[model samples]
Target: MNKLLIFDLDDTIFETKSIKKESVKPIFDQLEPLLINKFGTALTAQIIPELWKYPFDFVAEKYKFDKHQNTEFARFINEHEYKLNIRTFDDFSVVENLKQEKILVTTGFSKLQHAKIHYLGIKQKFSEVYIDNILSSERVFKKGIFQSILLERKIEPQLVYIIGDNPNSELKAGFELGLHTVQVAKFGQEKSDYANYCISNFNELIPILK
Candidate 1:
C-alpha cells in the first residue's frame, strides 16, 4: 500500500506550544497597551492567556473585536516569531529518512505559516502543505481538507495517518475519516481521546511511521 502521512504544522512539526509561551512577552508589548485602552488592564490580563493559545479569529469571536483591526497585532506576532526560528523539535532527520509520503495540513493564514515554513527550511519536507483560512469551523475545515485530499489523490483512508497536536482539529478529523490518528503531546501529558497513538515528542514518530 502507498502510505500517505499527514502532519499538522503548528505544534506538530514546529514547536508551537513553547513558541507561543516565548512569544507572549513580545506579543504583549506590542498589543497590550491597545488592549488596556479598550478592555482595561484587568480584563486584558484575563484574556491574553486564552488569546495566546489559538488564532486571532478565535480572539475576534470571543471578544467581539474586529478581525481587520488585528492585522498589525497579528503581523507583529508572525514577524517576531519568525526571528525566533522555533524550528522542528526533533532534528527532522527522522522525517527526511522516512520512506512514507507526507503532507502538512494546518489551520492558519497562509502568509505567517508560509513564512515560518520558509525560514525553518522545511518547505521540502512535505509533498503538499495546506494552510487554510478556516470557514465554518476549524474542525470542519480540517475534515474537509482531509476528505478532499483523499479524493484528489485517490488515497485509501486506512493507509493514511494524520498527525497533530490539536486533537479536536487534526486528530479527530483523521479518525472520523477512518485514517490512523497520532497525537503529539508535550512531555508527560495524557494522550487525547481522539488519538489512536500518542507521543511526547516528534522524534517518537519515526519508529511508528517507519
Candidate 2:
C-alpha cells in the first residue's frame, strides 16, 4: 500500500539560509530601517540574526509587531523576488522520485514562497502545494491543511507521514491529528520529542516508510 507524504518546503527540502549573502543583502538593507524605526537600534540589532532562522511572522510576533508594522513588512516582502535559482538538498531526489503521493505545505508570504518554489523547479513534483500566507487575514496553518488532505483523500491517519523540520509547526500538528511525524534534521538539528522518526536525509526514510 502507498502512503501519503506531506512535506515542509523551507529547511526540509532546501536550506533557506544557504541563499548567498549578496542575494539577501538588499532585503535586509530595506528592512533594517523599518525595524529600527519600530524597535529602535538595540532591539533591531537583536532581530536581524533571527530573520533567516524563523518565519517572518514568527519573528514579528516574538517582537510584538503591531498591525501597521506587519502591514509594512508584508508589503516589502511581497514586492521582493529571489534573483538567483535555489537548490534543494542533494538527498531530496529520494523523496522526489518516491512513488507515493506527495504534497507541499509551507508557511510564508505567498510571493516569496512561490518564488522559491519557482526557482527550485519542483512545483510540478507535488500533487498539491499549499502556502499558509502569514499576511493573509484568513491564513490557515499546516494542521488544517493536513486534516483536509486526510478527509479529501479518505486516508487513515496511520497511512500518512508529515515530514518537516519544525517541532512547533508540522510535527506538533501531525501528532495532534494522529499521523506519523518525521523530522528532517538537515542541519544537525536536535531530534524533537514529537517526531516519530528523525532523519538527516531522505535516504534514512526508506525503512521507516516501508
Candidate 3:
C-alpha cells in the first residue's frame, strides 16, 4: 500500500518556543503595560496566563475587547510581529521527500498557522493542510483531528503514519486508527506510551522512512 505521512506543526516541524520567545512574547510584554493600566497590575498578571491558554476569539469574548482591537492584536502577533525561526532538520527533508504522500496536520488558528507556514515557505511541501476551525477546538486533541483527517482524505488506517514530538495525543490517534507512529524527540522532551518507534532527531527518520 502507498504510505501517507502526517505531521504536527508546532515543535514537531518547527520550534515554536523560539517564535514564542521572540515574537509572541513581546506582544505579551506590550500588553502587560496596557493591561496594568486598565485592569491593575495584580489583575493583569492573574489574567495574562489564562489569556494565553484561551484562543484569541475566546480571549476577546471573555475580555470584551472590540473586534477592531482583536483584529489588530491578531495582525500584530501573526503578520508584523512574529518571526519564524524554522530549522528544517535532516528528518524534515526525509519527510519532505515524501511530499507526494505527506500531509501537514496542525490544530490552531488558521490564519496564524498559515502565516507561519507561508513564512517558512513550506506550504508547497504538504499535500494537504488540516487546520482547526475556530468554532470547534477538537483539533487540539490529536485523535479527534486525526479521525477527521482520515474521513476527509479517505485514507486507510494501515497506510498512514503520524510523526511528531510529543507522542501523547499523536500516538493515541495513530493507535486508535491503527496507523504506524513515529516519535521524534530531538528536543529531548519525555513522551508517553503509544510511540511505536522513538528516534531522537530528524536524521534518524531518513533511514526509518526508507
Candidate 4:
C-alpha cells in the first residue's frame, strides 16, 4: 500500500519560538489598543501570549472576542509578514530525506503562514501545502481538509499518517479519521492519549513507518 504523510507547519516542522517575541511585538503593538478597548487591560494582556502561540480563531474564541475585535486582529496579523529568515528544527533534514508522499497542512492567518513557508524555502519539499486560513469566511479546519484529501485521493485511513504538535488539532483530527497519529514533541511535550506514536525527532519515524 502506498503511504501518505501529512505534516503541520509551525511547531511540527519548524519552531515558531524561533520568531523572537520582540520581532512580532510591533504588529501586536498596533493591535493592543483595539484588544484592550474590547476586552480590558488584564484580559488583553493574557490574550497576547496566546496570540503568539495559537491561531487567531482559537484565541478569539477562547477569549470571547467579538466580531469587530476578530476583524481588527485579523487585519493586523494577516497583513504583517516576518521579514527575517525562519529556520526549521535541526532534525528536520530527516523529514527532508523521507521518501513518503508528504503533504503540509497548517492553520494560521494566510499571509503570515505563507511568509514562513517562503522564508523556510522548503515549499518544494511537500507534494502540496495547505493553509487553513482563519481569516476566510468559511474556514475548514485541519480535519475537513484531511478528510477531503482522503476522499479525493481515495486513500485508506491505514495508509495515512498525521504528524503535528497540537493534540487538539491535527492529532485529534487524524485520530477521528482513523489515520495514524504521530505527535512531534520537539519541546519535550508530554504524550497525548490520541497519538499512536510520540516522537521528538523525525528519524524516530523510520521505525514507526516501517
Which has the greatest lDDT? 4
lDDT for each residue of candidate 1 in 1-210, tens digit (9 for 90 to 100): 788989888866666665545534776787877778888999889878877777767776789765444765766656664444467766467666778888988787556677778877887978998877643234348888899999998988988989888876888888888999988885565788889899876578777765
Residue 170, model 4, lDDT: 95
Q: In model 4, what is the error at residue 25, expressed in angstroms?
A: 2.1
Models, CA RMSD each: 3.5, 1.4, 4.8, 1.4
Q: Write the per-residue lDDT of candidate 4 for residues 33-105, one digit (tens) a residue.
A: 9888887899888988888877777888887888888787777776776685578889989998988999999
TM-score (C-alpha) between model 1 and the true structure: 0.79
* Model 2 CA deviation exceeding 4 Å by range: none
What shift in Å separates residue 84 of candidate 4 from its native position after superposition? 2.6
Model 4 segments beyond 4 Å from truth? none
Output the worst ten-in-a-row residue range by lDDT, candidate 4: 77-86
Backbone clash numbers for all candidates listed? 0, 0, 1, 0
TM-score per candidate, chains pooled: 0.79, 0.94, 0.70, 0.95
Output the worst ten-in-a-row residue range by lDDT, candidate 1: 131-140
- lDDT score, candidate 3: 0.69
- Clashing residue pairs in candidate 1 are none
Candidate 3 Cα misplacement greater than 4 A, ranges: 20-22, 29-85, 133-141
User: Model-by-model lDDT, in order?
Assistant: 0.76, 0.88, 0.69, 0.89
Rank candidates by lDDT, best first: 4, 2, 1, 3
Total backbone clashes of candidate 1, pairs 3 or more residues apart or in separate chains: 0
